[model samples]
Target: MDDLPRRPINKEREVDVNLQVASLLGTNGQWDVTKLIHLFPENEVTRILHMQVGNVHDRDVWAYSPHGSYTVKSGYTLATKLKEAEAVRDASEFVEVLELKRLIWKVPTIPKIHIERLNTRGLELDTCCRICKAAGESIEHALFNCTMAQEAWNQRSLTDLLTAYLKFMPDETIPFAQRKAIPWILWAIWKNINMLLYADTQESITIQIVHGMNEEEKKWVPPLPGYVKCNIHSNWRNAKLHSGVDYIIRDQSGNVLHHARDALTFSPNRVTSELSCLVWTLEIGFYFKDIIEAVKKPNDWPLFRALLQLISSLCARFRSVAFEVESSASNQIAREIAKSVLCDGHFQSYLAFGGPAWLHQRILREAAPISS
Candidate 1:
């Protein structure tokens, strides 16, 4: 009303009053900017307040359309010409051992070949298999063809399991939990090999090869609407072996927006990978849309300097965000998903989908009323 001139008042007023009028809106509607300028120029304010570099987030999406909707027609147009302006900086790779491919991440196993490879660079050291002492060591020889390694594995109840895994690739056919047994057993075999070589024959380790696994049951809670929530979990299987991370994103209504669970075989450590989870989550969010509001985060993880730096620089799109941790009881679902990826031996990502069905069932069961 204040923005309109005295003469155009009635037409503007008539347009405002056409709430019940039979008219196709937006088809030919002409937007007037004078009204916005008079209304404190929020666009300008947002521009001035967010003028800093790296915070613009996006320029293609309409911040506020006249109709206040992201029209399908516009979306299609954007999609057609959408060579979206993007930049990538983190060149580091997250590696998985079971799904080995050509990559830079080092496996914890120190086979003869690894030593030999290093020796080529002038770091002279023993390049022979510690067990057989028959020839120069190699990843293939140490883990697979070595007489001692094969003998150790052959002695175990898992010999058939190891043989089968070596012959076939790990996939969905393998049970979620069963898949982990292979990796852990291999670690055991490697560890025992070292012991056998160094220890005296009289004090040799008897054939008691044992492995221990722990199970946990926890519940996950939904976030409130109008905001987004990201759940992250991480694990380090062997101190000298590997690490991995998992994360999930949801709207305030608890509907999943995105989810990813993967093994980080190359990751430096559990804490680093856990913190990297936050950085990757924030990076993904910023990659698609601008961050506006943040919610509570648990305080469980140590506030490492690298983690803090990652958040400040990568998540600069927002004015504010909170970091906190939740109770372990409420984190069961996410934990399960992370463990699944580690066992499944792959990285999985999904968008606009529901949470894991088994987890949802457990949640619903707990919420159900007891028999009267």
Candidate 2:
């Protein structure tokens, strides 16, 4: 009751401090929206409604760590982040700093080039860019500002194009097709720099970038004989709007057995959206009970906890069903199907026996055997 936000206009109103959480729920076991709005602020009410209710009793859990259990590592990380954030005067500046750190970690390059990491090891080394010899070899210099790196990006015609587009627009606003080569280009630049420094080998950046892109273009593989592979993908736009879930089931021969597209009402976030999709996938698994029984078998928040239990129970019914993660390239069709509902403004849910009519050709192309 102390933590709950009260309605600003009804400051004088009294609330029952002894009110039970169950009392806040409607007969259908969902948050009572009318009651919540009457007692709390609109924003707080929305947060309450978004929470998933479960049959288990509520208990205290740490918020910082996954599985709701706290650890010294998570605690230290939180403290360090809080200390860093406290130094920043503006919230947006803190967010930008965090984003910069995330970008630095995402660069798939040699760790030794980071001056801070090298300094922490008590090693005194030259900080100049090994290739260009003009600027210090910080992450920014090594990845973007160095002469060699700039030449590679320029060679791919991505320097001005990406800088101009990304400055004014969000990453998602740019089509993935146009920006897919950027990562490979950066990887090639980093690889070239590392080779020049350590291996004394000079590889052509253009050739490396082309080779990496070609390797990543591998298509999806089919399941083994007598087994079915279910490729699932989820699209979560925001907490306020509905999210989409798409799952396609295919046999060993690469024939689409069944597929579904669902527009879920309560996504809230990506984790919840994907978890909901997993639960929905398991529910769909019930339909293939006969096929699964012949095969034989194996093997989160309160909402996540409940979903995990449901998944375990579902797995028990099957003779042998395993979950494997595939890259976005391999599951491109499923990803596209999931994105279609949100993109086309079709909020309805549907299940079909074969591949989607609109994507039939693309599906056939994806299912085709690769030529040697």
Candidate 3:
């Protein structure tokens, strides 16, 4: 034991003597909070207490990859990112770029239009903007600089437009009627550009923009009689590593039966945050047996093995369960409720009989049927 290297209890602090991990465990094989409280901060103590203690021995696990196993592809990606970080003089700009990439995946626009750049370097294709025919056909020029695209965006630049869209569009605090049509406008511009270039047809950008905006305001459909629907949404913050899960259960008559919001810490990524939300819903007696069983065999997503197992065990209590994906507009209330943890500072977890008090009016309005 004396020959072995000692590990520090807290790396943030500099201490001459280090302690073994086993010293932190009590006689019952659980984390001894008494020892942790004396050595660590409150948040660290809480995190340590939340950790699961398995019967098996500990082993090495890779952190970079999702499956806790290192792969050459993942290694190369990490290496490239590290090299880029080292080369970039401005750290803030690099972080902003990384955040932009993360947000790009979450946007629900057409996939083809989401390409970061067009490869026109080696190709014999025309490099000028197809619509304006003035500037080079880069992503920025095509999306924002072109005369037609500028008209669609009201002459806003890409940075300003994206910033405004991300700030107000997805936020529930912004009234539905007051939200800008940035996403749809951007989509229409891309779509029209594609049609003109590929099909050699000139379509009215104004007409297409109107159609795209109207599509987002579609009414939510209720489930069939005798069946209930569950709408779930998760809000994740990358910087804080915190997540919030909000879910609403409604009957065929569009009446909300139950709603809940739970905040969690140390969520690794969006995928893990979503998986945690599903597990929370199941643990609270809202069974999704079909979906749970389907994901129980974690051959591909080994990072979620523990969560999947918990879900599988919970599913055994129920005979049948049904689930269907709900549109972002339909699930808007639930999504907002989840985001309230961060926005409204409601960080604590709670299971409520109905929708939250702050969003009571919005909930009532959404539950009502649209008069054709």
Candidate 4:
């Protein structure tokens, strides 16, 4: 206290800091996404909510890689795979096949001999090949090298499918994960072989990866009769405030009505970015006037407590105007546009336009068989 003078702290500065703290309830106590340009990403919040679903037992799985178990080697391998995959023609297809990645990552397969490694703890399980008996029972040996199982891989249907799938892929440049759908089938087969070797099971069945993709597809949904649907997407870079926002509007019958995408002027956090995109999307809908009926967004739309009230406000504005959420995957156009705005620094806008040319091709591809 000897040579120090005490004065009151600046109350205005305190209030300013509090306001900048980024609240769902706006500065004046209103919900506004643009005002709080910094929020957590929606997917992150969704995963958290999913975890909070309260399991009888808690389980943790690594999300960044396909194996659900993270390691330094796996991370490095995944980073390289992602970098290389960005250039691959069918890279999207590879992502759809997690089983394939789990099988191939770090080459967890035949030549490496997973069975011997399993017995390293001294389980005393026989290492001899169940099929050929010439060598140890390893993944590769059981699948291909073994004289008996060799015919399974050599089956005309499997070979023909592999040949047809590979005809569209480059042999040298593309990573093996992106090469063919055959690996998923092979991995399924490998898993069954292990079940027979270790677990007590009987049937040897085949699963076609290509056919399964079509069977379990969850693509964008069209609006119901007398309604208009819109998809929204947002992206925020880690450790940075700048974010990208995108939205696409379509009629009930699935005709594109309008679309717009832009980079945010401020870095509202990821959750905030998505909320802002949702609000911005609705605001744009207010422009469509009488013709606009209802809006449908991704099921993960309302994570924050404030969004429900904000959605309530919109319901009073027009007849049948409601914020509907669904698990259906929307057209990837908004996501593509948002990423483009982030990477290329371009503001994309379309009025009375079908969408970007790239999206048209993607739409066509989605219309075709099997989208990964």
Candidate 5:
């Protein structure tokens, strides 16, 4: 028999050293401002304390001040209190909460396209959808809000699922966590929808949800309510989606936080031709949307105006390609009017993008807010 070598033993107590380090610098789970400050040297801490940026309070300094404005819980707005009601439907807040969740989870879930930019530029283009060329794409042009997505949602029984899931949630007034299940379910359904639209061919949303629910149930500690079906139709191939609008939102470091497809269509028949033409034209406009989102700041008004002109040119191009009709003279006039309004750059970015550009200009002219 060959001689066996003795295994060396660890005598330096590496595990104990690691524990000591963990105690000094909190673990990932316990990470917060105090935990972060403890890792810095006294001089560095002092420097941070002295660094002031006007009235904005620094959390590090505020931590030491006994009478600081920081509170464990902030007062809830009337809107916040109302959100708890299950029956109240506030689309704006729902979108905001979904965005907030995406931020919190560091997940790319919401569709945050530049609606203003898309409206300006996607007015023209000639690109056919790879899967289906019946329509092109733009911001307000995707699955959640558009017609094609509505078809898919109908096919997948999304409305029913959402309704059932929502029933289990706290109304508009409920806390986010209490209402989290529905959003999660919707998110999963949306993901499956995207998979069908982008990766797979002509998949039924219902089948995808059934399969998804099954997998989700296995992973859940306590299973969710809806039943999941496993046996998918063998003939249920994915549909070929030629053209669809999608939006991508990225962080400062160019990390994609959200991406969503608008819709996909295959119809280019005589009666539906105009609708398809309009849809396809929007693709050109999507570029402007992308630009707006990229330059998401207060000083991008000039860029926005340039985008409007670009949209007009694109729309004219698409109209020529599809209908052989000359570009709308009114659209050109609108562009000129837009330029005059933006000349001084004295408008709120949010309100500027919300209403009709002409209406916005009128408001500026009169120095008054418009009635709803």
Candidate 6:
């Protein structure tokens, strides 16, 4: 061991309550002993605790307003203080309760099988696993258990591993369905943790995890757009894409109202069950024409074209409207929309117009004329 230096001792301690109070009050500090007495009273421990926790000294009494000055103000009762304290305690307890819940459940609640991150306490900890709540929330537990997570999983179509788990808890280590969906399980756990922490919700943690799993499946087996397998002429004319736009109508308290969603549709199909690719394309083209016609100025064309291209890319593989193959109703709508686009005065004067003419004629031949 290395030699250490010895310390000199015997310094006298001084007590100056005035100096302490002066320091707390600073030069501008004031005092109201009567108010402090009134606010604190004789029996209440709350005022003492508040002073201790807030570190308020005699001189610091100036921080309060004249009416407040540590006294019971007119509007604030002891009940108010109790409520505030309860709110604080409840908030703290809420998170603790969730943690306790995880502990009660046997879910993997930690770092991934391979990686780890620091916990809120700054200690290097495993990411949560779903299998054991005490372990930290992980994908496995969230998708399989924890009430809410289980609900989402059960409600939708389950994968083989999940299905096996649902049917019966198996012996040994691996189950029937999990081998193919391990990553998905993990991702769900992580996503649910994030949602729980940041979104301030008590949503089914398991359902969130399952959603993550579904998202993973969606990635592997990307769904084909409706139009890909649909009858092109029917579905496109009856698409229901217009409902997708949900404009904000009012503030949370219903104060001010605003009208949004000014953009016109490129296609206005009702999205029936039987639409085909041809109908889908027709809707797209017709919607595009509508947007172009709605514009008030020539310069807006550039912006409109850019927006049209974006819509096209987003809906590229989306399932288009479906209609009965033998029904001429959808067919006529498609023709009329196309014809209107072709004959629009704006298009004739500037934009070159070309659409399905034969299909339009076919639809007209099959339709009954209407007059006001």
Specify the highest-TM-score model's number: 2
Task: Tell me how many residue pairs clash in candidate 5.
Answer: 34
- In terms of lDDT, the poorest run of 10 residues in model 1 is 291-300
Cα lDDT of model 4 by residue, 187-206, tens digit: 65666567766775634434
Model 5 misplaced stretches (Cα beyond 4 Å): 1-141, 144-151, 156-189, 192-204, 219-372
Candidate 2 lDDT trough over 10 residues, lowest sum:
291-300
Question: Can you give the TM-score per candidate against the true fold?
Answer: 0.34, 0.62, 0.54, 0.45, 0.20, 0.21
Global Cα lDDT for candidate 3: 0.67
The TM-score, computed over Cα atoms with residue i paired to residue i, of candidate 5 is: 0.20
lDDT of 2 by residue, 42-97 (tens): 77777777766756556666666644556787777677667665666456657877
Pairs in clash, predicted candidate 2: 296-319, 296-320, 297-319, 297-320
Give residue 204's error in model 5 in angstroms. Answer: 5.3
User: Which stretches in model 2 have alpha-carbon errors above 4 Å?
Assistant: 1-38, 56-60, 65-77, 80-135, 139-185, 188-215, 288-303, 370-372
Candidate 6 deviant stretches above 4 angstroms: 1-110, 113-115, 118-132, 154-193, 204-351, 354-372
178-273 per-residue lDDT for model 3 (tens digits): 355566667777888878877888777667766776767765677787877778888988725568788888777667787888787766567667
**Runs off by more than 4 Å, candidate 1:** 1-221, 290-304, 348-352, 363-372
Put down candidate 6 lDDT per residue, 205-316, tens digits, no spaces: 4565566555444311111322221112222222223211211111222211221111123232222111122223444444543222212231323312323333345345
Using lDDT as the measure, the top candidate is 2
lDDT of predicted model 4 = 0.54
User: If both were scored by lDDT, which would come out higher, candidate 2 or candidate 5?
Assistant: 2
Over the stretch 1-372, how does candidate 1's per-residue lDDT look in tens digits? 112112222223234543311121123332234442443245443322221112122223242222113666655545533322111123223224312532432656556557666666456767666667867666667666787667655654456666678653456776645555566556655666556555523122223223322322334555554677677777656434445567767664555666666565444345555655666667766766721112223122222333544567766786545556655676666677777766766565544355666577754443343211
Model 6 vs. true fold: TM: 0.21
**Cα RMSD for candidates in order:** 20.4, 9.6, 10.6, 14.8, 29.7, 26.2
Residue 281: error of model 4 in Å? 1.9
